[model samples]
Target: MLRGSGVTTLQYTALTVLERRGGISAAQLARDSFVTPQAMADMLRALEQRELISRSPNPASRRELLVHLTEEGRRLLAEYTDAHAAIEELMLSGLSRAERAHLRSSLDGAWRALRPPR
Candidate 1:
């Protein structure tokens, strides 16, 4: 489903990680994305060439560079995310937006109540 958007699963994972974590080091990104350092380096080069992400030297550590997702990266991620909204709309066609929100909240609360403590 994601490849249709010109992004592979690993690339999508990298973008999603950036969206969630904001700016972070490439090594951290690789670890979070479940990729090897060498694989991450090649992926970073590809993402940079596509202008989906940018890298800057980290002031705290001259050896590591910070990675950031570009607006275009967010835009691309949104395309896939928006599809979920459409699917939800179809599945929840009988419910109003408010009802759906309430249902989601109730489900979350139930999950919290049932989950064992870490």
Candidate 2:
């Protein structure tokens, strides 16, 4: 459903994570996007080449770099706003507001439950 936008789902997922988290390490982006670090490294290269994202040395950690969405990246995400809303509407159309909230809570709980021990 997300193809043909010049952006793969995984790329979109990484962008979304960066959007929400502001700036984060590539490894954190990988975990949040359900991808391996190697895969995220490749994706970040593509995104950077496309000018959709930028990375800079982390001030708090000299050895780490934080990835961030660029203005173009924000524009790209905004362009899909309608489609994203429509998709969510279609998926939740059958449920009441309360039920939707419950579903979100359940999903969050499941996500937390499945995470490996830190």
Candidate 3:
């Protein structure tokens, strides 16, 4: 979905998840994205090295690290968001605005319903 829109899938997914979930631990991201913990850690390390994200002390858990988006990360995320929106529009070209909204809402609801309880 991302490469079709001009961004790498990993970059797009990481940015989108960070934008939506705020700062999260690498472990949490592994669970959320369905990626392995080691894979998520590797991705996070790469992102951190690129200055796109920073590993900071977690507010809720002092011993844990939280991944926060840097200014560059936000900029990339904005670009990714635009690309994603364009992809969505192209994919849903035949649907009316209301139908698209309904589909989005229903999908979100279904996902939430299937998620494991906190």
Best by lDDT: 2
Pairwise lDDT winner, candidates 1 and 2: 2
Residue-by-residue lDDT tens digits, candidate 3, 1-118:
4454444577557767887886788887777766788888888878877787888899789999987778888887776666668887899999998998999999889878866789
Per-model root-mean-square deviation over C-alphas: 5.7, 1.5, 2.8
Give a tens-digit lDDT track for model 1, residues 69-95. 999998998888977568667888999
Give per-residue CA lDDT, model 2, range 1-118, as digits (tens).
5676789989998999899996899988888888999999999999999999999999999999999999999999999989999998999999999999999999999888866678
Ranking by lDDT: 2, 1, 3
Runs in model 1 with CA error above 4 Å? 84-118
Which residue pairs of candidate 3 clash? none
Alpha-carbon TM-score of each model against the true structure: 0.69, 0.92, 0.80
Please report how far candidate 3 places residue 31 from its true position, in Å: 2.7
**Count of backbone clashes for each model?**
0, 0, 0
Model 2 residue-pair collision total = 0
